[model samples]
Target: MKKKLLNQPTFLLGTIITSIMLLMTFIGFFYTPYDPTQMDNSNKLAGCSLEHIMGCDNFGRDIFSRVLQGMGNTFLIAVATVTIGVVCGILLGAFTGYFGGWIDEVIMRIIDVIFAFPSILLALVFVSIFGTGKYNVVFALGIAFIPSFARIVRSEFIKYKDMDYVKSARLAGVSDLRIMFVHILPNTMTVLLSSIMIGFNNAVLSEAGMSYLGIGVQPPDASLGSMLSEAQSYLFSAPNYAIFPGVMIILLVLGFSLMADGLKSR
Candidate 1:
């Protein structure tokens, strides 16, 4: 059943689409048809043509080039956010789980408090406080996700703390750090990887959302969210403007989701 599910068409498509997008992102770093940020006001809003594929945006920047570059920025933000959330979460969870008592209660309470608010709202609040930019957006998104990752790690720790291996390590006078990382962490990797994948997808979406709302990565840097936001105003006439970035976002999200599911099933 698991193998069949992993081999499904949707899964394959997700994988392929994600790979291609990622490839484009790397390729974009070195070469593209034109500068993604360049504005040619004279040629603004041109339709797809031999010279300008994917049309020109309102500012006359090549949509294709901008989209590719935007994907790259999106990837950067997602990676940073996930890394921050995961590392901090794991450390906090391990401490709270292994030590228990007041430590666990304090950590769990913090997680509860953060989780009380919707993540998006929390992100918005952070972004507003910090001011808008790529770094600020990543920081906001990362902070928003810490509670989830911490909670998951705490659960894993609670589940495995009393196993025979842990007991043996404890009796052998293994350092708490060693026991946590060497004995416990390895067991948690499967769940951690799945959680990180979920985090990745959420980070991308959240960053895109903030950008669309004009509170995220600034102009001069093409972001899928920013593009979509701009496209919204011209929906009736330039439906393609919104459609392309929207599809890319969906593809990326679906890709992470499928890969996460595959890992969990394994």
Candidate 2:
């Protein structure tokens, strides 16, 4: 099963793309052709050349460097957001599903209330209230994404709570915590893993949208969304400024989407 999964076409393709993006992000820590934020008015809007492989933006900052740096920021926010969502969702879902009765009803009702608002809208509200920054955006998106993961996890836990293995663990004097964490959690992960990937994709998109709207990672730090936002004015004059960042966003989302699909197929 593991070998087949590793060999799956979609999985392999997604892995390759994701790996390349990660490599670019890692490389940004050490080197880029030029400083992404350094502006050289003399070279403004220059076309791709040996010196500037991806060309220069209107501010004359190297597009390649900005894109690489943006990749790192996007990855960080998305990973952090998904981590918060998954952890909180799993804990709440496990407790509610295992305990059942009033606890389930109350927790699920709360989740439903959160679900009433669209994720983006909810995130926007959070950003508006907490103000803007990378961590703020992560927190906002993480809270917004919790309901979806909670519902998925709740269903999975409910499905397994009464299963033979779980019952066996219960009968064998295993504590509820142990059964839920040690046994049920592992089984639930197969499905949860796919959801996690999808959530990560959504998180990246959400962060980009928030940043584009001016509530995400602020200036001095680059993000694909912020780059696109800044380049909007120079679209006709220097299309490469927007083009590279747009492509990076699409590729990043595509990689996660494909990986989710592959994991689901497993």
Candidate 3:
């Protein structure tokens, strides 16, 4: 069943959307209709036409250009958040799982405490205290996701630690680091890859949520979240404004989710 789903055209469409968004990220760096941060008072609220494919925003800025630029900003935030979370999770989980003692107890307890609150709520708290900005948003999102990565990696480590190769590595006087990396880490990678993919998707959504609340990337910086927030006010007259960014987010998330599921099944 999973194989059939993997083979389907919808999955291909998701893949294509994700690929195109990434392509736009790099392509947008060198080209855009106008600087996304620049405002044109005269062009404000211009409707879709030959001059503006997606139309102009309330500020008369090009919606299509902003969306393109926003994709780049969004990609960077997602990559940073996920990279930090996954790396921290892997190291902490390895230490806790491989050495299982007071170390494991303390780490797990801390993870449990962090998990007690809803992630977005926790992030909101951080954002509120730090004030809204790009770094704050990234930090809030990264920290919010740490516990899940830690827990997942810890579980993977626990499963692989008892395997014969690990036991042999220990007996052979392989350094603990060597055993963890040379033996355990590689074995746990399948699960980790899937976790990272899901983490990437979550990072995208989390950033959007923060932006919607005015805590994410500031205005003038294009991001799907900020774009959606701006479009909400014009949904009646410029439905395409909301629709395009919304679909981009959905497709990006769906692609990663599907790829994660496929890897897990294998």
Best by lDDT: 2
Model 3 TM-score? 0.92
lDDT of 3 by residue, 75-161 (tens): 899999998898888898999988899989998999899888887898889888988888887887888788899998888888889
User: What stretches of model 3 exceed 4 Å from their correct place?
Assistant: 1-14
Q: Candidate 1, residue 254: CA error in Å?
A: 0.9
Query: Which segments of candidate 2 are over 4 A away from where they belong?
Result: none
Model 3 clashes, total count: 3
Q: Which ten residues in a row have the lowest lDDT in candidate 3?
A: 5-14
Each model's TM-score?
0.93, 0.97, 0.92
lDDT of 1 by residue, 152-247 (tens): 998899888899999999999999899998999999988998889889999999889889889887997889999999999888777767877888
When 1 and 2 are scored with TM-score, the better candidate is 2
RMSD to the hidden true structure, all candidates = 2.3, 1.1, 2.7
lDDT of 2 by residue, 1-266 (tens): 87787799998899889888888889987887778899999999998889887789888889999998888898899999999999999999999888899989998999899889987788788878888788888888888888888888889999999999899999999999999999899998879999999999988888888888888889878999999999999899888888999999999888878888998987
lDDT of 3 at 35: 73
Number of clashing pairs, model 2?
0
